[model samples]
Target: MNFSITRLEDWQQVVDKILPQLQHPILLLKGNLGAGKTTFTQFLLKNLGSTDEVNSPTYSIVNEYTSPKGKIFHFDLYRLKDLDEVYDIGIEEYIDNAYLCIIEWPEVYEEELYGMKFHTMNIINSETAREISFE
Candidate 1:
């Protein structure tokens, strides 16, 4: 499915549309820098009833959140040097136990992710709006 958002306030509507399609705990977000990936994630977490501040885990690699529904794991793998670093951080363990795992820059370890059942969203940014397509 595809969605276009012209403003931040419309993020919730996108989340609402996609919520029912989320059949798996893993979500792979693909986009360039400043393409609204984190913005969309913040909306998603909030919609899921999370009160904690949501930010990119660029340096930390992973950030955990407690929502009214359950635990959500947000991972930013942009800084990792290799796939081994993913193991070093015990990503598999988190994926195994998380209620939801939203990953950014997952292309860093694309091969490893092939075996997992994850929802993929690609965000395309324009001067006036952002387009999100889910697969």
Candidate 2:
């Protein structure tokens, strides 16, 4: 699925359509800085029945949230230098235990998920709006 949004409220529409289509626990978000990755997540978690505040996990690496379904672990792997750094942070254990894992800047660890099933959402931010592609 793909979407183009000019306003923040538009995120809800995108979230509504994608929520039902979310079959896997792992969701890889790809986009440049300030491209609304975290904004998208905030909407997603709200629709998923979460009451916790959502923020970028850039420095913390991971943030946890709760929902009627189960636990959600949101990760930001942009700061990590390599796979070793990813393993040192216990990325595998988090994914193993999470009900859902939303990873932003997942390039470093993406290959590690070779045969696993996961969803990918890419956002392209332009001067006027943001374009999103989900699969």
Candidate 3:
């Protein structure tokens, strides 16, 4: 499914559309810079009942958020040049322990995550609005 999010408020509907179908618990967000991958993460975390702040993991690589449901690990793998880096960082542990894992720049390690039930969220934009598609 796809959604056209013109404003932040449109995200609530986007969340409603996607969250219920997230049985896989793993999401690969593919988007260009400023295309709203982080925004989708924020919605997911907030809906999971997390009160803590949600921030991008661009530099840190991973940020953990805890809620009553479970812990979510958000990862930005853009800086990783090879799949070996994922293992070096003990990222598999996070994937195993997290109730949800949302990864940006997952193309860097897509082959490693094969066989996992993962959903891909693609974000595209025009001059005005960001369109998000999930499958």
> How does each model score on TM-score?
0.95, 0.98, 0.96
What alpha-carbon RMSD in Å does predicted model 3 have with respect to the real structure? 0.9
Tens-place lDDT per residue, model 3, 8-34, is 888889998888988887899999998
Clashes (backbone N, CA, C under 3 Å), per candidate, total 0, 0, 0
Q: Global CA lDDT of candidate 2, please? A: 0.96
Question: How well is each residue in 29-70 modelled by candidate 1, as lDDT tens digits?
Answer: 999999888999999998888999999999899999999878
Question: Residue by residue across 70-100, what tens digits does model 2's lDDT show?
Answer: 9999999999999999999998999999889
Which segments of model 3 are wrong by more than 4 Å?
A: none
Error of 2 at 70 (Å): 0.7
lDDT of 1 at 126: 91
**lDDT (Cα, 0-100) at 16 in candidate 1:** 92
- Work out how many backbone clashes candidate 3 has: 0
Enumerate residue pairs that collide in model 3.
none
Off by over 4 Å in 1: none
Q: Go through the candidates in order and give each one's C-alpha lDDT.
A: 0.91, 0.96, 0.89
